[model samples]
Target: MALLREREWYAISLRPQGQHRRLRDAVTRAGGHLLALSPLRIVALDGADARSRLRDALAASRCVFTSPNAVTCAARLQALTTSRTIAVGAGTAAALRRHGIANAIAPDRMDSEGVLDLAELQAVAGQRIGLVSGEGGRGLIERSLRERGADVVRANVYRRDVAKFSPTALKRFDALPAATALFVTSAEALDAALGQLDGERRAKLLAFPTVVASERLREACVRSGFGRIVVAASAQPTDLVQAATTLV
Candidate 1:
């Protein structure tokens, strides 16, 4: 009788806390295990100043959301309204639709450069653009819009903090299978996740086949010493999981 090949796969998730359910479920359905290594925690900023900035963003001629977290946090502060709405990616656009902002559109490339490539943004000589996002990211979008002569107002609705991992989490990571793949989407999350690891563990992780969300992230993985890298179709949970499963 011929021996059967084993088909178990493992993927390390570096998404933010409370954002791993869909990816976990997808990995489970693919007959694989998902190890949570959430390196970032999202904190919603709903203070008076945050609310006022959100109001200004909503009142602008064009409003742009940088992430799903931005959409959710902005929705919590107040209603999302604008003449035209743009999301950095399809995921953010979906989040906006879930919050009843159905007219939001996203670029095909799903990045700062992609957002800037949109034709709608090309002719903004004297337009007010509101950027709804987390704290201290997506500066490229703001800068480019301003260079295009658009008055860009940034409304920071959330902040990303480095998450603390427990001892058990480190132990679990140490015990991960040799054939496991690393899934990295956000460059910030990647930096935070690797920063929390000791040298040995970090080197071991860099040796794994990494699946990144974009070419930019692939370059980041290369610079971070990841030996092998693969770019996923998009940052969507299903896409990332699908790409990871192919590695092992």
Candidate 2:
């Protein structure tokens, strides 16, 4: 936490949800400036069309949830007959428990590749698997499971939509102190930030350092001509703080 205090400014790419207040406090206590990028909205998949497909996937041999939003959506999809539930991370697993669903497993690492690396899934030949996540996420999990002879069915439970900029929205970035490091959790979030910025605001942001969670997002930033893009070792907040400290 002390390390994070060394930075003059920061841009937090968390959606404008109720949970962001805690993160905002953390940044302020660390003595870093924080600009809240528009929150990503989660739309549930509760329509009749989606319910039928989700029912089919729920009958699979096992179920996988890619995010907490997915777990919440899956819980609403009515009765599920899968024998096991695998979550991409501890957070997602807890979300499942919140919805009264048990038998959830979280991988040691919190990513699609890590989930596939689990011993339980490695030999899942001829098994049927259901993947629950938001629409249009990375396809690694689905592709890998299919290659391993598992019939993978993806159930999209939600869609992310960035918040529209209000009159006071730009002030968040404008008030930020100089030399702030922007933290981006995903490539999609980064794209939304860029799209939200005006031409001048975009140039100003390009001058600040950026911390991304994955190599893929870092590469995207580089290709977009961002000045400095640092990839966080992991998605955890501690890892992000360490990376920010290094740059600061």
Candidate 3:
């Protein structure tokens, strides 16, 4: 993180495909200023003729976008050609709409549990579905869909690459007070940020009031020794900003 504004203490950002701009804008509109600083980037790897494979996968009976990055990377190769599309979160759904993919199935809750609860996935017998995601996920959705008698396949289109922070950003973060509110979007981001900190920076992270998107993340933060955790409804920028504004 970088650039600590006096009133923007709670504007901490977590990695979910680098979507802090929308959140910061929303917070500013709500009469609060939120600043986000991140050096981590998500990059797509070599997937052996990725464009062709992704094009083929998109033609499945149903397509599930595991994250915003999946939607973005797949869209780069080709427009979604599936009979139906599903997004794992509001951000991913918004990305889909930007690519002209409407009527995407997005659950009220933005997690694997909520995605499984959808009516479209319930009776998926004899269906062929495509899971558009990156590597290193729990595979719950894929397994559940298979259990429902759907032939499931995957197309991993991207991976997260943690970037090194400059000396200036590190100094800025170290200077932030413990009163600064931290926004922990994903468990991975929390882990990465904490791993980067030491001495006073680590101490401040532990003491900072944090806003998370899901109960799962809140539980993770609890284990990581974070106090004053606030869980938002979803990872949407609006939801995140609302939680930060109200809590911090």
Candidate 4:
């Protein structure tokens, strides 16, 4: 995505730490300020220990990391037989790389459809594959991979819970003189942020050009009366920035 900011831009990140840093830096370096909105819901993995369960899954199958969160968790899950790793997006692939896991492959697009297009996945059609992600996500990857004859085993590594909004975010929201623009990565984040605000703050936020990462999230914004909702081509920050150009 190209940098196009006619007005001062405020970059919003709804994802976790690994996903946020690089994109936030990219936006800021390109002349936009950042507002971090993390709706992190702690994911309680089944069983007494998350790592042991993840290890069991990894040992039995290849791994598909759905987000940077998944990548971070999978990277930390004590190597279990060196399973194959696939990332849902470039940022996740980068996360795996940063953690010294070099075999991770990312698709051209970040969605489930993009993951199905990988030749490696295509070749492994009857094999068992492990999915690493949080709860409450669309099961597109799991369904699609299963349709292609892959046995998808899900490994819930961590949980997602909403984080408290930073004082900086509140200050920024209060200072906006007119209808502004907002970029978000997930519905959970959007909901969490809105949930944290008072009625006055919600009114101000509702009057903005809103951009979400997926069509599902767009619907969420529409339900909340967001002024305009544009879905990013991919969840990548660069893609979000590109979408921002059209919104502006």
Q: Provide TM-scores for the models.
A: 0.95, 0.85, 0.87, 0.81
- Model 2 TM-score? 0.85
Between candidates 2 and 3, the one scoring higher on TM-score is: 3
Write model 3 residue lDDT over 1-248, tens digit each, in one string.
22223554435665544567777776666655454546467887555667656766687888899887898888776767677999998888888998888889899999888999999899999988888887766388989998999988778787776766658767667666544567777677677777777776778778878888888889999999987989988887677766766565
Candidate numbers sorted by TM-score from highest down: 1, 3, 2, 4
**What is the Cα-based lDDT of residue 173 in candidate 4?**
65
- Cα-based lDDT at residue 143, candidate 1: 91
lDDT of 2 at 91: 70
Q: Which one is best on lDDT?
A: 1
- Candidate 4 on 137-242: residue-level lDDT in tens? 6488888888888878777777776678778767866876543458877777778888988998888788777778777678789898786778888776777767
| Colliding residue pairs in candidate 2 | 15-39, 15-40, 16-39
Q: Give lDDT tens digits, candidate 1, residues 1-248.
A: 11112677788899898898988887777777888888999999979999998899888989999999999999888877677999999989999999988888799998888999999999998998899999998999999999999999899999999998778878999998877989988999999998998999998899899989899899999999998898998888778877776688
After TM-score superposition, the amount by which residue 133's alpha carbon in candidate 2 deviates from its true location, in angstroms, is 0.8
Clashes of each: 0, 3, 0, 10
Q: Residue pairs in steric clash, candidate 3?
A: none
Go through the candidates in order and give each one's C-alpha lDDT. Answer: 0.88, 0.73, 0.76, 0.72
Best by TM-score: 1
User: After aligning candidate 4 to the native by TM-score, how far in Å is the CA of 133 from where it should be?
Assistant: 1.5
**Candidate 2 local distance difference test against the native:** 0.73
